[model samples]
Target: MKNLERFLSEHQQLTRRHFMRLGAAGAAALGLWPLTADAAPAAPELSKAIETLEPYFTPREKFRDVSRGKPLPHSLPDEKKRAVGLTRETWKLEVISDPDNPATLRSPLTQKDGTALDFDGLMKLAEKHAVRFPKVMTCLNIGCPLGMGIWEGVPLREVIWLTQPRENLRRVFYHGYHNDDPQQMFRSSLPISRVLEDPFDLPPVILCYKLNGQWLDSERGGPVRVVVPEAYGFKSIKWLTQVVLTNLYHANDTYAEGNNDIDSWLKTFAATISVPREVKPGEPMPVTGYAQVGLAGLSKVQVWIQSNAVERPTGDPHFTTAPWTDAEILAPPKHWGALPDGKIPANTLGFDDATGQPRTWPMRLAKVHWAALLPGLPAGEYTLRCRTIDEKGNAQPMPRPFQKSGNAAIESVDLTVKS
Candidate 1:
């Protein structure tokens, strides 16, 4: 509890690059949930899903297929896209509850008189804190860059404290404003035990009012919103309005309704990037791209050297260490056809570039690494394979685990490594 309080106070403003810097110094630290108040730190445990899949721990050989996903729905522009403006007051803020009674805590963020919380006050509150690195922002699109920018706001824990909950509180829920009917609005939940449970907790889950250090336009969760450190972007809940606490499990939010589809455990899946599919060996090779897991943080990442010269798998191979040197070589002019669609439904993996076909398996991974291997004597053919492991032991699976939403799960990449 002491460590968690300190972490929340310090990291409420940590930036993505800084987090990466921390990773560079050492493998990322995993967030361990305490089973009981007296449990020792070394006692290892598995999440519900991990325990269920304990039978399928067969690690295998795989390759990295870079040109996997075509694009994302957000990339299509017409899907969930909406134009947001600088208008601030049009939005309303809400403060639900602390850690126990979500239903009874439901209420709008407002003044003592019950009027909605004003945008100006929210902005002022955001600026009062000392944020370290800017919050990283990434659109749901696969082809886009992982955006990094400063976010300003109060620690979400602070707000929760202000609302106050009963003594036996344990978890909390957050709901964001949605254009869909109130019943269909986007919402997610977090474990208060975890929120206030660590010492590294910095930049408390902020009630973000600014993005890139500027007031957010309505398009983004504007006027006000929630930013959590341990959950995925969806769980961050934009245009946030209410927060509730409950003792029982509630899986009825947007993603939860789909059995928590792409987001069940919050683990970032592994992927390989080879859109252009051709790279010259030698010279300064640029291996650029991003990888993400849900709430389970990233621990180690790996990229293999491959020559673009053959048909390959949809995803990248499992990567456990950096600077992969023993990667397989590829033959030149490899004519890989469209990614093979498998058990997981098509048009479900990732959207097709030409056609909006739901993607499958490896094709769902959006980002890839690019490399210009050391200058070579001859240029026959080559390919690259890549994969990642999160703080937890989970790796991106081959055929993504069966789920309603197509979000990738922990699995290894299977690219065709060539040279």
Candidate 2:
């Protein structure tokens, strides 16, 4: 897979002229239960005891649900869905200007003369412009991710640019079904530039409808959802219903109320997956976890372990001078195990359609699952910590500490070796 990724990279570079393309957080204040080591949710499927390489694609249903809605759109009763006009048969998408303060581009894309987009219409559009790629969906404040998936969707620009949006459209903000209540609307925005252009070559903002090549089954934001690969989870509003091209230049995120740094980019972080509490003096202790590559990018994952009985380095809380060992980042998995036939769908973005392999290892804005085996420790508990070194060579939490932005704390665990 690593070789394949390298081949894909070199391939893209060599063919750059021919092909161009493409492509927070918060919790409590807005009613989100952030997942962390201590608060790990009961996702039996996601709990990997494997201490080696973690699975590449998470099962759609197995992905943790940290939904923000009161009665999550997918969890809504059939009658409730109908009452809110979210039933697949009757759901309609209104790509319009804010009615109260209409922008120059009003009702740019619509079915018939001016009808909202229906499910079938969205499907029809997908046939022409859908793309697929792996993305790690994580929370802003949490130290862990909800899960990863091969998200499939149509580029937002493809849908918005069809009619050639007119003037005064500074931003494009969207929202999903929220019980027709303004307070409950899980809304987010993007500078029109972020949507229409890939200035930094970041992943294209997509109107996602499928995961792991499977149609979302309600609970996973079926029918439609927004997938913003760069930003945090809040930006990917699910059960999408409306997309507004607004002249409003400022972001209109729902988490803005009490959340700090509503516009901060997601910071890179690492979370340990498995660390056995006890091991013998001559035994190899397996350690594993995943590192989230952020806008800063990722260089490598490192681990530090020291006997609990020994005096710690008092001045180095950040472990700047600690003995850290590099961990091996696992290549992409052999069998995705996500798709029905255990084969990636044809033409997954960032992948070589011919071999169905990703073009690179540790893709930016994705997770790099890592593993390491610790040498025999004589006795006593050991303070074990792991973190990621970003592309800039700065250690975890160095470049970006936990602020109003997000948590990038150095994660640690106490591992006891039986005497």
Candidate 3:
């Protein structure tokens, strides 16, 4: 009787649909439900068809964890506080100039003058100036992107001007919390122009905190990270701690020491997904993969297939003259599972505020997946390769042979059409 009374109290709050969903649980709680069978008949299908969509945002845990430190702070159980200062309540930020010159400013930025920004202060500033944008982060050396994300933060320009910095400062660099060892201190920089003003429609360099609508965790380079959309992932330092204005004229990126092109903007390229090795003749073979839209923008994804019997006339390693055909770039998802509530955030940069659609079809500085269908073939082995064409009319590895700037190579898959 008591169980019935308690259930009756809670059941009134549940919708008719949820009332059915919870009745079994209520029976279980009262020791009256079956051990295996469902409480009622299954409901009818909600939709006649389901659309396959590529994920828009990488889950925080699913994102590649490329954090660098002798022993990563998030990996150390008790020492996270001392190492990276975890948590939103305790976060702090500072934008300062070289100690010698003391920066040109409207508000004198002496720590004594209460100019250091706290987490609350940063949030207050974001009320008006916060911006969000989607970007796919690709490392210069790595052939694939680390991940794609909807990043939200105030532009670095907003933070710097609070200190009233000037063009006299040639560069601005920042680094995240790291192990105290000076040798492990990783830092990256951008030209003062890159941070202070927008040019060529580049996404403004931002000090970002939220990822996929959640407070960034320590493992993902939060309380804040600097996001430079036009540059490779190297330019976006993680676990941000300080912003320093400097007079040095040359790029001082730490990645430069590892013999990398410090300014290697991500290049347009494509790589294959799962392609079958053997298939019966007369069946439509689907080839699918993703393309990275670089600063040059992407016109289309191109694919070329040839049987193994065809001997290539030696000397064209980059395949400059391969007979290629266009593939279909997957359309915008009817539903965005990775986005919050399946709605594109209107505040996203470069997207229409009214409709929340991108101004350009395939957004630049991002990644788009594509697919092609191949007609059936008789018993034979063949190879299929895919590459992207940029808006400037250049194919993969065309304008750049990919020496050290960024990895620019065509990806291929082998398939066998059995009899």
lDDT assessment of candidate 1: 0.40
- Pitting candidate 1 against candidate 2, the one with the higher TM-score is 2
Per-prediction backbone clash count: 69, 2, 0
TM-score of each: 0.51, 0.83, 0.83
- Mind giving the per-residue lDDT tens digits that candidate 3 earns over 1-419? 45533432342232133223222333232222232356542122101001122465676777887778877866666446644455576666777776654445555344456667777878987998898888998788888888888889989888887886544687887887777777888889888878878889787888889887778777777778888988888898887777878787777689989898997787888887656678897554655578888888899787776667666668988777666767656554444446678677777887787866678868888887655455556566778888888999898887876657888788878888787
**RMSD (CA, Å), each prediction:** 19.6, 12.5, 15.5
The list of candidate 1 runs beyond 4 A from truth reads 1-86, 97-115, 127-132, 138-146, 195-199, 261-287, 291-301, 306-323, 326-382, 389-419
lDDT by residue (183-253, candidate 2, tens digit) is 78878888888888776767688888788877776787767888887888888888888898888768888
Stretches off by above 4 angstroms in model 2 are: 1-54, 99-101, 106-114, 162-164
Runs in model 3 lying further than 4 Å from the true structure: 1-53, 82-84, 99-114
Ten-residue segment with the worst summed lDDT in candidate 2? 18-27
User: What lDDT, from 0 to 1, does candidate 2 have?
Assistant: 0.70
Question: What TM-score would candidate 1 get against the native?
Answer: 0.51
